[model samples]
Target: MSTGYDYSWFILTQSIIKKEFALSGSEQNPDLTGKSWRMTLRRATNKGAPAPVEAFKSHGVDFIVRDRIEDLVAEMNKLAGNDLLKLEHIRMQIEARDREIVNPYVKDAQVMNIHNARRYIGDRLIRTAAPHRILDPAQGPLIAVKLNILTRKTLGGFETDLDSRVFGGEGSIIPGLYAVGEAAGFGGGGVHGYRSLEGTFLGGCLFSGRNAGRAAAKAVG
Candidate 1:
């Protein structure tokens, strides 16, 4: 399943990895699941991400850690079994992005998005890192991850009537049976268009579930 956020080009620094990368899953985040604000605050301001993130960096096959970009690209190419990425090309992009931060009115969209996200007090304090050059050594060793595509949403499934009654093979409603969420195509799959934004599947799932629940309750009454 997709993690819902794209980190394909995300370059993590050794110093910020702990604070920047929070591994997915409930068990990976004791601070959050346990509702310990004090621990959470520590993680936010801390130099490291969570323990699980560190473990992945140390042992995960997809992770490439290097002191230099050239070496990093070499490892990446080796891992991918091809020389598709060029060191110079990647460096140029990093340099160009780094130059944008010098001006407050930079035209870079991604940088602008980061700035906008950090405008909120909460994001500024705990989420968004202060803008910095990627090549800066003070941030520590650079890290690249070979992100893999994950399948999550099922675009279409069993057909259903407006009330979420499942349609049988002969185009008839199956009595006392219903479907919802992804099974019902997320409210006929119209809540989100052809392409959905990151982390938006939940909205469709919740909406369809609510509709099915209401319909089932009404039928019973």
Candidate 2:
């Protein structure tokens, strides 16, 4: 319940937000990495929030990122004020594909587990002649962000900061607060954390969701 996130975490997020955020420019389409899209209103959003970059269009069906939808709706609704579109209507608008500038998917993970600091994230401050530290899409492809995450010690029988299993032991004590997929350490065999992986979040969500449903059913019974 009380996962103690320290002040450093706040500072880190602020620093990261500043570095990661971009100011959207008109005449240019936003292209989020995944099917995600979030844009400022046709009026006043300057921060370059990621948006879907049109290439996702295929025949009629298309993918939409949930994060983008939430963000775009919030921004537009801010402009709409009391006239905010109904959630259903908004859904209709979404299905209608109303966004102009958009981005695809984005990095949803709060952290990345690396094998070594210099090799993986790399020496950000001296990455290039341009004087770099993470890659920015605006700077072109091959974007990279060399992060130096805290290397917390793993004592085992608990969740590691990297969301890894430090050792095989009696797992989490969420108290019938079920967990599955990566939460319960799926496919992470032997390693303490995930060195590199993607889409685990979605898979984890599905696994956990199904369990929650089953638990609910059992409780009801």
Candidate 3:
């Protein structure tokens, strides 16, 4: 949204890939093209992400809503000067979503400023704590983060032209042409700008596949 947050991952990885592989960044900065990271592939392409510090705002993302759910009720009841109970719950929610997807600011202790913990673990939710934030077994269940983490991955390994190619120009290929998902190459690989979708490779496949299918049918007929 804003801008100024400098992303090191994109800058570092790209540098390594090119310095070692002799590969090009897009086509323009074929030289320092190594300065971008796979993660920034989206923002670098998006009309938004101008800089990092400015783009990285608050922590807005999807997470588990924790009210209280435990797999072991009995285990939760057995702890008392003894190691018996082990029940837990985890969930939290936030107002920002889109911003979190691209640039998520990981909080410390992960406990937000509201005394409540927010999680972006695949889904959003309120991970509640014990009364007065005691974190006691008797007070309530302890909400924790799920194993699966939710994050926005960048697009790369392929190159897409944005100049004469037009935005999403390859969206629909002509008959006889076939596209192989990411197999194509750097998407929106231009000197100045690019556009990219999250994980909708099927769109590209369908467009190219359809063209091939039609071409095959005509040849057979």
Candidate 4:
């Protein structure tokens, strides 16, 4: 839902979601819920977003599918029952973002982040898409979604270390106890440091969970 305007939302192409869209809940992601790594990997490398995302595009109330930006904006404005969005304004912003794809070292922070993500073996294999222009016809027909808030995870909480041991105000590890997952602030009380990004929460939780289990096991042994 980021298009550089507080009042405006983003219009993602079919290509964008394939790498980024991951629906939460058991019913939403069968592979994930079933704990099948093979199926989950296949889903990631699949031609499009998971089944649930496609279902949303086809049936969700907030979604609008269109081949042209003009038509997409028109439908979006109509859905909101307001003229607050302008075609020219939206086009200008999209064009600007698309322009960043050409740079080897892009100035656009989001685009740069996309490139950064692709550098990781796991992310490159399935998580992030290669840098490409948003308006590129090959990646379209455009998909505009009227996004609604769905809380997937919390931001920050109790601080901990690599072993998931809670830290006291005096910066010492509190003994005989451990924290992990969301309880460890999704890893060391905000793994992203000063600036957190989307999709990092689960990874933090998994990492801390392992550390906590290992530490607690050794402590008892």
State which candidate has the highest lDDT.
4
Which ranges in model 1 have alpha carbons more than 4 Å from their true place? 1-10, 15-20, 23-27, 162-165, 174-180, 187-221
lDDT of each: 0.77, 0.32, 0.30, 0.78
lDDT string, candidate 1, 120-161, tens digits? 987777667778787888776889888876656677777888
Ranking by lDDT: 4, 1, 2, 3
Q: Of models 2 and 4, which has the larger lDDT? A: 4
In candidate 4, position 96 carries an lDDT of 85
In model 3, the worst 10-residue window by lDDT is: 7-16
**Where is the poorest 10-residue window by lDDT in model 2?**
6-15
Which lDDT tens digits does candidate 3 get at residues 1-221?
13432211110112111111221124333223556554334433332222331122112121121234443233223322244323331211221321332233535333343233224321122122111332223322222221223333334433323211212446643433333334443232221125554334446545544554565666668
In terms of lDDT, model 2 sits at 0.32
Query: What lDDT does model 1 reach?
Result: 0.77
Q: Encode model 2's per-residue lDDT on 8-87: one tens digit a residue.
A: 10111212332243433333333322222333232123221223222221111222112243443443444334434455
Ranking of predictions according to TM-score:
1, 4, 2, 3
Off by over 4 Å in 2: 1-29, 32-146, 151-177, 186-196
| Number of clashing residue pairs, candidate 2 | 17
Between candidates 2 and 4, which one is better according to TM-score?
A: 4
Candidate 3 local Cα displacement, residue 196, angstroms: 4.1
Winner by TM-score: 1
Residue 197 of model 1, lDDT score? 59
